[model samples]
Target: MSTTSLTDRLGSLLMAPVHLLMRIIDIPLRAVQKAAGIGGMAAVFLAPNMLIFGIFVLLPLVINFVYSMTGGTAFFISERNFVGAEQYQRLFTCTNYLDPMSCQEDAFWTAVGNTFWFVVLQVTLMIGVSLITALILNRDLAARSFWRAVFFFPVLLSPVVVGLIWKWILQRQGLLNFGLYQFGIEPYTWLTDRNWTFIATIGVSIWAHMGLYTLILLAGLQAIPKDLYEAAEMDGTKPERVFRRITLPLLAPNLLVVVVLALIKAVQIFDEVYVLTGGGPGTSTLYLTQYIYETGFASTLRNPGLAAAASILMGLVLVVLTLIQLGVGQRSEKKGKR
Candidate 1:
């Protein structure tokens, strides 16, 4: 090599160690500075979010509990001067608490029962329908994208809009009736009938929800290893056996996720019920949340105290349910690990 080239090459080789040492020396300090900066920035940014949460969520909860204790016209009353569990007692005992005509029994408890049934039915239907849709979409079906979009379209629509649309469609003179007319069948009042109303609401909820659940299950299906299915087929396993042994076991985590989400959504249903039936046809579709809203805001009594008590009770129930779900999930994970 020429002298200049030789010297340049030697300098580069000598400088490499220095560069490496500098990088090593600087990394920890740079990392420490970055972490500190991020910590400080996060604190600053989260202050507003924390304030908003306290104002909206935490404050309402605290106020609810406080109000639940106080009795009568004035709102600001001391917890010491509080009526204790009288609110809870009245929730069951007092016929005039919310509904005057329904005085023989607690409407709150009835609403609770109805809400539980609604949740159970809707969650089961939602998970089942979504799982089936997900499996079909996961296969090498024609117009896959079109089918996915079609299935998920309902999820994009607002619940209120969906309820309104379905209400129109299910009316005696609506699309359903029109189709029935062509078939020479008598038109039925879907919303007017109690059993039919319940069924209609459940159907609408399932239709609106399947898209999201299907998407979630489809993602899970994609994550499953292809080799498992191949091995199952190689062993001469029937399709049913393959699904039960391979697909179900592998999809357990996804199913759990869909179930939990469906449960929460079903339990908290309001808009659809409100728009479709307005908790009407003789309180047939009156859910717990609707009861709470009506008691707190819509009714003439407007007992904030009772509403708060009901809310706290509902929150406790939700917390317990969530804990149960978590426990189930943990057990499943452990089993999977084994």
Candidate 2:
């Protein structure tokens, strides 16, 4: 045979078993399609994903809610007694709502306070810094790609590694203090003071996660039409005015996404802060997630039911944030259509 004919024969030989397997599969699938139609086939294809979601997500959520309502330190669901909303009641039972010391679950309230401040400060700073970084990176600069990579490198690191790196820099006798010592200044413990520790947590968190937000806002910035800026420039429009009229309006959707995501992430902050501070300077850096984790798994007096209740409360906050995001998104979509 000629070379072309020999190649054709080899290709046909390779495809033969694949074609045979498809033919065998199609026989049963044709019968299924005739009986159930296209929609049924879609459901059949989706069944595996749905089963995985139910097992991993829905099942645990139901179990957590159930555990929240029950009392006792029992690991087994059957062994625990259902005390109704007793765990919630204990959490809410405070002589003064503002004072954690007056509450039955004082550590929980302290965490709530710390988390509230952390969320407010961290989210605000995170959004501001990310926006500034994004704006700067969007401009034409030397080694632009390298600068972008440098800014985003922290995001590629594990949260624990971020914590450890910052810890080494901020701890007593660490890099920061050693620098101060070299400058003929007394070494100071950055992680020991309560105020500084809390601030460090916020700073470290912003550093670790800011790269992702910067990338997000940078994408948004890039997506804005250069034509708009050009038009504004031709008309002698001020930079501030151009940004206000064109850039901000165009970037609103991406800004909305960044805000909601950052808000949720700030609420759930744990690993990095945990590794950095261990909820000390005496619970100053403690947050809701860590509170739940310690209560559920790490505490000497482990209380899963109480932990579940706290988690459910936290989940409710997240649900509200999600609903607000959905509402805003829908409203924006409606406005766009209008």
Candidate 3:
């Protein structure tokens, strides 16, 4: 080799160990630098979301609590001037609190009972109907996509619009009455009868809500392995037996999600009730939410404190219901594992 070439080779050979050593040292340092960068980026991203959550959800909850403690229509006062849960007490104790319109009697406990009934009936019916619809769509039927779309389309429409459409249909001179007249039946006031009105409201709500639930359940159903069903069938299991043994167990998680969602939505139902019955003919269909709205904003006696208490109570009920669902789900999972 030439002297220059020989020198260059010798230099490279001498620096190789140094280069390797530097790389070995840099590896840990680079890892530490990357970790720090990732942590900083995560903090930056999370900080804004946390701030927004605090501003909106947490702050409002705190404000509601504070307002509940204070005896006020407009101004915030000391909790020492607090009525000491008198508002809550009155909800149970008060009787015959008449609406100014003279159209209905508004009893707090009665409204609470009505709301409970509404939630239970609506949630149960909504979930059941959705599950049935999902099962139907999940089957190997002709025009499956068409049927799925037909079922799910109602969910895309706003609840307000659904209520209005149903209202028009159930009107005295509407399609329903017109059809009934062909059978020589008189036009019945669907909205006027308390029981019928309640049923109609539930029907409208179910129509609006069932589509979303069906879609959710259908997705869950599709995720389940077909092999499981085939295995069940090969073992001489009937269709119902196969579904019970295979599908229900596998679909437990999705069922939990569906039930909880239904419960929450049913409890929070306001729009359909508002539009369909306006909580009326009487306060038969009047939900807890209607009570809150009327007390806080619409009525002659705008009791923010009372409304806040009702809201807080509603929140607590929802939290309890969710916890119960989670507990049941966890128990079911443990049982399945065993």
Q: Highest lDDT, which number?
A: 2
Q: Which pairs in model 3 have colliding backbones?
A: none
**Which tens-of-lDDT digit does each residue in 1-338 have in candidate 3?**
59999999999999999999999988885776587686575665577899999999999999888767656566454533576686676554433444323223234455677788888898888888988999989999999999988888888887789888998899787889999999999999998999999898888889988888898889889999888878877888998887787888777777887888888888888987798789887888888888888887788777788788788899999999889888877987787699
User: What TM-score, computed on C-alpha atoms, does each candidate reach?
Assistant: 0.80, 0.93, 0.79
lDDT of 3 at 68: 72
Report RMSD for candidate 3. Answer: 9.8
- 2 versus 3: better TM-score goes to: 2
The positional error of residue 47 in candidate 3, measured at the CA in angstroms, is 2.0
Q: Which consecutive 10 residues in model 2 have the weakest lDDT in total? A: 327-336
Tens digits of lDDT, candidate 2, 89-134? 9999999997999999999999999999999999999999999999
Q: How many clashes in each structure? A: 0, 0, 0
Better of 2 and 3 by lDDT: 2
Model 2 lDDT vs. the true structure? 0.93
User: For model 1, how does the per-residue alpha-carbon lDDT over 1-338 read when each residue is reduced to its tens digit?
Assistant: 69999999999999999999999978885766587686675675577899999999999888888877766645455523578887777776754554544644366777787788899988998898899999999999999999999999999999899988998899878999999989999998888999999888889999998999999999989999999888888899999998898899888888987888788778888898889999878888988889888887788867767877888898887787788779878987787799
Off by over 4 Å in 3: 1-41, 75-82, 94-106, 325-338
Q: What lDDT, from 0 to 1, does candidate 3 have? A: 0.81
lDDT of each: 0.84, 0.93, 0.81
What is the full ranking by TM-score, best candidate first?
Answer: 2, 1, 3
* RMSD of each candidate relative to the true structure: 8.1, 2.2, 9.8
